[model samples]
Target: MKTFTVEEVAQHNKADDIWIIVDGKVFDVTKFLSEHPGGKKVLVKMAGKDATKKFKQFHNDAIMQRVGLPMQIGVIGAEKKEEAPKPVAAAAAAAAAPLTPGKLVSADEARFGDGFPYGDPNWYQDWNSPYYNESHMRLRKVIREFAEKELMPYCHEWSEAKAIPREVVKKVAQAGFLNAASGAGTNPSVASLLPYPLPAGIKHEEFDIFHEFICVDELARCGSGGLLWALQGGLSIALPPVMNFAPEPIKKKVVPECLAGEKFIALAITEPSAGSDVAGLKTSAEDKGDHFLLNGEKKWITQGAYADYYVVAARTGGAGMGGVSLLLVERAWEGVEARYMDVMGMWGSGTSYITFDDVKVPKTHLIGKLNEGFKYIMHNFNHERLGIVMQANRLARVCIEEAFTYSMKRKTFGVRLIDHPVIRNKLGHMIRQCEATHAWLENIMYQIKTLPEASQPARLGGPVALLKAQSTQTFEFCAREAAQIFGGLAYTRGGQGEKVERLYREVRAYAIPGGSEEIMLDLGIRQATKNFEKRSKI
Candidate 1:
């Protein structure tokens, strides 16, 4: 915390003893000149000078935190400053004034983070809203901080390794993130069944669906879709069927272990033959007197290779949706094998092709009734699609945030990127789409809360599906536009454009999963038509 004067910093101008000020913090880069990616000439040019403008022109906050902070020698001392202009001073005074009257929430208390404007939700900037409260704010802060400290720094590293370390996964579980992310934290019955408490010390009764939204949204802020999927994607989809419909014996054995992070699970529904056609899945489970002999091949199963168990959908009778049944299959059992698949993105998710060669699943492990798994699967889609909406929407925002930040610091044609009308137009589209999708998402969340649980599938499914498509498409548009803004830097794997590059590669992962955009668009209209007819009493 030592302060250095401008005169004092000027004394270290030599190449062997260099110092520069950035945003009032002094960094002694004497030893780092050789390691500077921009080369020694740039550092030498800024030696013993305020390089705040120059440094930001080529670097980002992540680079600052990772490389610059460590070399900090001291901060620039405060000096005499110019007085504020009359108009600016008056505007500042008015803006700082207290709420005129009847403000529901204090500006300071409702504000969530200091991120860039629109980088977070409008609620984060003290905008009035009915959906969130102090409890939700508490959970947001906790998860955001957790993601920043535990996940963001290592996202690229883990994605490259294609595996998240077990210890970090355990920490996430211990913090109650698993329960929240799984859609279980908001369900009272499911919450009672799990061992973990709601995150941020909110009791089960106080933890509403919006809190669940916050959990997924904040974690996605890490800007690594692979890491987010690897951690919770499979469990969120797989565990719910068990929690909602499995036999008592199966629930007793499987739910606790998975929630505790002692085991992992994947939803093995998509087969090579069936992408969106869940009914066409060819996996079969023949009934025996003692157990079900399972035989199938599951493709593109998230977390499949790393999972200890799988919630599998297989044919139990005839050859369509009516015949499909969900079963909880143990990975440790005989004849079960999983091998990782090389995919375009979501590498850290352990996407795999799994085979079941005469795997024995106890009859007790059957989820709900035989031939009734289709209903269970259908019921689960609302939550799954909503989760996708949460992730895709935030990831879209990450694109806006990264591109916008870069546009500020990066100059083009003798001006900042934001100063270009064409660049602003692209950013405008990204912002508009992202914000509109977010509003739609929040509305769906509100409907989920107000509508009865049993009525939700019928009432909310179509809207959720459409929202999923909207969000992923928004994510896609933002990723592409952000890449355009970053230009060559977005093509690279790391540095200032790391997040934009990674997200651009991940656009397909979001769009194709949780129902493809084409499928969702049709389904939304069809479902809405059916609902409209029913509402008219026709």
Candidate 2:
């Protein structure tokens, strides 16, 4: 690399041939002036001057990695200063100290996530939190390492392919993630179905909802909802009902295979005519003595195109919510068909439109009691919504993290973007939303753990619904702000703005799937009012 003196670099500072020093590195940004997101005027002001302090204040290291380093022409040579050595006595005392479990010599010794402020949940980076312990921290570390190494590198590739490789799914199962996600690590019956132990050093007996929360949160950090859904979207929602309500034989046969990644299952409930209104589903399961004849079409079924089993909601009694029943329908049954559906986002999830015509479902496949499926389905919503909440919050953080990193390196007007008050305002709002929603989510998780099982369904339904809406809205806001910060880069897929673009597309997917924002708010208020009235009467 060529080296330059400070005076030599100063001579090249002009509009037609501009050079500037940032962190002792000289960059020939003359060609880039026209293409700068903040316009050419900003570069003109900093011509020939060292902008290291101004640069570091506004941009993250990502800016240098993505664009700054490539423009470097030479390094400025100046005498480097050496740091004073630590006192020998103090150093000797520090080295002689014994290592103890969970004891750190310094506050800076332990760090987590990407080290970006609000890039991860506050609890992740040594903040005192009631909801997490060393185990949760350990789980977060292992999961994040796994995601960075195994999944993140190919997340975009898999999203474009519109399907996750089967072997990857099997690998997830082998790692015990599938079992943990399927509620196996938390529920005894579900745990019994797992053929292997939980992930190394994790005890099934200690696994709680927060651990499950951590798993989904880490996966969401991959920044592709398509990949997260393809991996566990269907399994998280579909398998819970079976584990909680299915007959022993059905559980033994189906749960193990799914948990082992040998078979895939999806919950098929939404139809062309019915979505949030589960009671109005048109899929029918007519009783035929020994078997029920299933006939109907289910649209937007996550993982449906490749599933081996489906926990389907069909009409068996009269009409409305009372008549619905859950059934385990085999994908191989005659008249069963599934075709992939093209969608805006989450492409790799293999969302499908499924048709069932005169499909025979044995009586043993029925989940819970006849005409009581609505209750079971309603119960499952809390978990599904919670999963959505975790992913949305993380995706929101991904947006903020990406944009925050970009702002520091992306100069605007006469300074870095982060130095602008408007940019800071946007980031401030994003951080507040993410932190507030996450706190609510943690509070609810605590409630679910402490509340009686039966009371949870009625007590938490309203709050969970409200939190889901809050989370999706937060995600949408962050995605929008991040896109604005990146401008054109965020408009295209791949490169620095890839995650922002992908997440922008995925905003609606989260807002609409668990229940649309409007519906969630309304339902939340109604349920809360009803529960409050009942409690007051008592």
Candidate 3:
């Protein structure tokens, strides 16, 4: 690559001769100099024999090692990005018009036009996304603002302490974020598509709810996977069953309580021996006409430490899924207690082992119906998985963003490390994966929002299952890569540097939650077969 001066690179109109390829993420600095926020100083500092070392010095490791993947932020001038290489163009030659009007060029085009350096137009001081509509845009803005102000400020400290102030959760609840599908006059099941009845003109309200999800995504930027997981798990457990299965009287009592921060709920399914094997769960609820006597020990339950109510899945019949039923068990019931289960991540999520010693649950609190609890559980796993999926995607995004920023300012070997092709390729792949996963997730999310709730079936399970597997796996991969990129600092408790180190310790749990990778695959295979059979009209 021909080296150019800061001014030359900055003034690099399309006509500039020298191509300044900074740290390998690629940039067509050809015209960026004029548009840069820092003026020529930023580029000038990056000039000279090798600015890598100085660049490293200027930025933090988080940015250098974990800049976000491609296309998370809207492109400023995507038209000029250097395209990835094309396959051998054995195609008959075709001419193409260049921007210069009369200039003729070969039809072959690079996949990415030209990648710009960090701190370019497409960059955010942090993360940003351009979703489908105004509601999404507003939501993204709200989340970004919140992260910068609230979480970003205290994230490093909290990561070190492994404690998210209860105030944070309380504030989030106050923000009306927890009321996702079940707004006033909106039946809980109405959140589902297909047969679920819903009031007209509520799509916007639903869209607003998804925005709250954005708040959750941005929370990961705080750098504590465990904290994010602990907080979010409540949403996963509480929303679907309570909204769909709880009786109106129960809903009236609990929903408002949950919203008021006076109570919390969780869906209890995992047990000491039956972590992902739902069918093997030994939890049982025997009917005594007026109430059910339950006996089981549930482990690794998020919110277990504080949940005032639980959507408990129990063995109501004989064996397998058919024998199962969901019951809403209140904490006030006799013989119910939760013990803390210390963990590597999500420290304050109040994870615990919940024991039911002949716990008495009223018959009215049964979730869904007897022998039909499995379907209701199945009904919401996809949404739960997607939530996991988004977290995984966002976690990777954090890695990329932090790494990229670090790489830009950190100088090593006399230049910004990003100028190295090897580093760029490594970081580039991370970016690509995150963006691809995000795109895939957004597509599925759109479908879930618009598809009729009635049409959701066991067959639909396959897609969500596949996504759950893919999302967690993707997150784990990116986290590892980001760690490697950060080198040493990634290993230590960077204390307050948005602890990527902390994330490494927490990555394992992400794979475990919302059903382990193994369970996801098994469920995916079964659902895929069902989908295939339906497709064949079998």
Q: Which candidate is the best by lDDT?
A: 1
Give the higher-TM-score candidate: 1 or 2. 1
Query: Per-residue CA lDDT of candidate 3, range 1-538, in tens?
Result: 2333445434433334223333433345435456544476565444322344544543443333333222011222233457773332211111112322444444342111113332111212112233333333344445555556655555555655656677776665555444432232233343332122221112534553345445556666566666665555765656567767768777667666665445677878888898777878889999988999999889988878878888888999999989999988888878999977877776667788999999888898887778888888877777777777767777777777667766666567898868988778878787777777766776676666667768755545677777778877777777787777677768766422245676677777778887888878888898787778889999
Against the hidden true structure, what lDDT does model 2 obtain?
0.85
Q: Ten-residue segment with the worst summed lDDT in candidate 1?
A: 91-100
Decreasing TM-score order of the candidates: 1, 2, 3
Candidate 3 wrongly placed segments (more than 4 Å): 1-131, 181-213
The clash count of every prediction, one per candidate, is 0, 3, 75
lDDT per model, in order? 0.86, 0.85, 0.62
Q: Across residues 1-538, which tens digit of lDDT does each residue of candidate 1 receive?
A: 7889988898999999999999999999999999997799999999989999887766666677667888998888764466873353233233223322345444554455665757998877756667866567668777887888778877776777878888888889899998898888876666657777878878888778898899999999999899888779887899899888988778878888888888899999999889999999999999998899999899999999899989999999998899999999988999999999999888689999999999989898889999999999998898898888899999999999998888887887899999999998998999999999999999988998888888998888888888989999899999999999999989988777888889988889989988999999999999999999999988
Q: Report the lDDT tens digits of candidate 2 across residue range 1-538.
A: 7889989888887899999999889999999999876689988888988978766644445456556888999888954557895453343233222223344444443445667878887655555566765566667666776777678777766777788998898888888877766666788767667877776457888889988888888888889999888888878899999989999999899888988888989999999999988889999999999999999999999999999999999999998999999999988889999999988999888899999999999999999999999999988899999989999999999998888888877887889999999999999999999999989999999998889989898889989999999999999999999999999988877666878988999999999987889999999999988988898985
Question: Model 2 has how many clashing residue pairs?
Answer: 3
Q: Give each model a TM-score.
A: 0.90, 0.82, 0.72
The segments of candidate 1 whose C-alpha lies over 4 angstroms from its true place after superposition are: 1-21, 26-51, 70-101, 104-110, 535-538
**Candidate 2 at residue 293, lDDT?**
95
